[model samples]
Target: MIVTRDLTKRYGRTTAVREVGLAVREGDRYGLLGPNGSGKTTLIRLLLGLVFATGGDIEVLGLPVPRRVRDVLPSVGALVEGPGMYPHLPGRTNLELFDAAGPGGGRRDRRRRIGEALERVGLAGIDRRPVRAYSLGMRQRLGLAAALLRRPRLLILDEPTNGLDPRGIREIRDLLTELHGEGTTVLLSSHLLTEIEAFCDRVGVMDGGRLVLQDDLATLRAPTGRVVLRTPDADRALALLDGRVEGRDGDRLTVRHRAPDDLNAELVTAGVRVRELAAERRSLEQVVLDATTTTSADRADRAGGDPA
Candidate 1:
């Protein structure tokens, strides 16, 4: 439901987003992940028309941004940066003002919609409390309530759980999952790898202002080519396997190969008794860390020197 071609954004001389191309289909629980300053937020802003793209094109819900933004925005809910609320206003008042500003039909319908949104976010019981007195988690829920006032088909959330505690995070996660079940296409940007892995089917990883990789989580999971075998003849097995032997400890050796049959066959042929064999895959955290690794050159630039 969203597409971008050669999308680039710049702040003065520094590039924020660079020649990035991406597409999110209907019913996609897409996660955009990257380190700080990797253009995740810039890309989100460009999509929402919050900031003009320095270069390239972006379409949301099949309409050009900053052009059909009027038609597109009402159908899209976004919680970028954080919820901006008037401290003096009550929680319900904040949503009422925001809903009234939007394309609502009548006062009664708007109130009903606001109530539903507050209820959805678990703030229905405390709707009249002033926002100034609300906790960070409460404010976040209030922000979510405001975003839902329009009943958006697409939700673009940038760290929706920024200030939330563990319980709050789970609440927000469950809420997002519920929204997804109800057919809302979610495009979220987060730093939490576990959070992304929990709900996102696909992820687009960004580094150095570039869209490095975008694929399904299953496709991106690290290969499980490493197998450990405990054998009586570790030296013989190591030599027999050659470069496939990654590490050895006592009678046990770690072999990096796709198939267990090949290792077993070779060891058995060489008259080595295989006492045990086990397989292991790299963790999801490792896969993401490897993908978004900052090169030494990047570090040098950040250190006020030319790329090393």
Candidate 2:
């Protein structure tokens, strides 16, 4: 439903996004992952037409962006920074106002959609309360409700669970799953690796303003076929497992591709007692870190910029 080619964005001499490309299909939950200054937000802004790209092409939902963004926006719902609203207004009123300005529809339909959205986000009971009185989590949910007011075909959320407690986070997760079940494509950018792993099937990793990797989540998060051994005699164990040592963490050692049984047996034979031995898999966090290793040059390359 979204495509980009050589997508570039710049502020003066520094490039925030460079030569990034993606093919996000329908019925997919695509996660955008990156580090502190990795341009994930900048890219999202470009996709939303909130900011024009400096160069290259973008097609979202079969329409060229900026030019056709208005046509496609009816089918798109986005919760970017936060739900922009009047704090003095009641939550329900806020939603009503948003619906009036939402995709064109009948008044009765808009009212029904508003009710459904509030109900869907668990704000039906307390939507009468002023938004100023709502907790952070409540505000977040209310923002989500506003996004769903139009029953959008595409939901683009940036850190949708930012202010919620664990339970609230879970509720939002379930809500997203429900939307996906009904065929709403959800695209989100977040630092919450576990949450993304739980919901997203595809992922795009960004670094130095470039999309370094984009793939099926399972393939990208695949195990490294390694084993880790935690032994008291780490030094001796390291010596015994010479050629197999991948790396070490404190008293723990990562031994390459060898079976635990083989490592255990070898350690025993070499008189180095093993405390803990288990198969190891590269974690999502590790994969992200490996991909986005920032160097002095990468930092220097960034111009401390955000899209207008």
Candidate 3:
């Protein structure tokens, strides 16, 4: 669990996060979405106590950050920007060194824990090649493996799937889902809308270094009062529905109906051959676009602003 109030972080004249009130509950697959330099990474760092905030409060796992960050860090796993590793060392050796440097975990079980983590990240059969020889996707997996090294109760991941192919992404998603099912809370920050849409239960949107929206994903994606009716008898269905029909394209009709089941029943009774029927809903993309302003890059291009 994580909570922040009026959490503002500034680098000189540049504000990376402003007046942000973030709440991530236990057992939540929370997705933090934003454009490039939108303060997501900064916020993550603040929560992890990796960066000090200019103003406001931060709480992670029920402890005040920075002051008590050390107490809760053993229970927290994070991958920010990317995993730092000695390129000349093999993946296994890098993980060994990382585990040794971190607190908690018994030294006797380090090898077994490392092996399990590697297996979970699809690197079970990885050879003794140095990390520098691994592909981008492989490196990403190694970073994730590092995060999962301790099976922390909370995971704070930024751009977790960066450089991964579709299959790799899905594998990671499944792995995270499995971890969530085992009571691990996930705070995922990514630019990939589809990944967030598919994996997250709640979402938070940030813009201009501000927390613009935070709510349940289902509530944000609530269905519109319209049903998409696909039928071979589009003209007939349109005639049957009359003024309720809002738009039509070929065999598809967008009808202003509150109940899709009732609409389908009426269409069937009226001899309309319905091919498919579903309620229209707002997509994560639409919700994010509506909540956010221009990207930080765009803002800088116009005014030479500071990066988040």
Pick the lDDT winner: 3
Identify the superior model by TM-score, candidate 1 or candidate 3. Answer: 3
lDDT score of residue 253 within candidate 1: 88
lDDT of each: 0.85, 0.86, 0.93
- Please report how far candidate 3 places residue 113 from its true position, in Å: 0.8
Root-mean-square deviation of every model? 4.2, 4.6, 3.3
Can you tell me which runs of candidate 2 are displaced by over 4 Å? 228-255, 258-279, 294-308
Per-residue lDDT tens digits for candidate 2, residues 227-290, read 8889999999888778888899889898896477876888898899888989876777877877
lDDT of 3 at 19: 92
Q: Which residue pairs clash in candidate 1?
A: none
Using alpha carbons, what is the TM-score of model 1?
Answer: 0.82
Q: Per-residue error at 177 for model 2, in Å? A: 1.2
User: Using Cα atoms with residue i matched to residue i, what is each candidate's TM-score against the true structure?
Assistant: 0.82, 0.81, 0.94
Candidate 3 structure lDDT: 0.93
When summed lDDT is taken over every stretch of 10 residues in candidate 1, the lowest stretch is 291-300
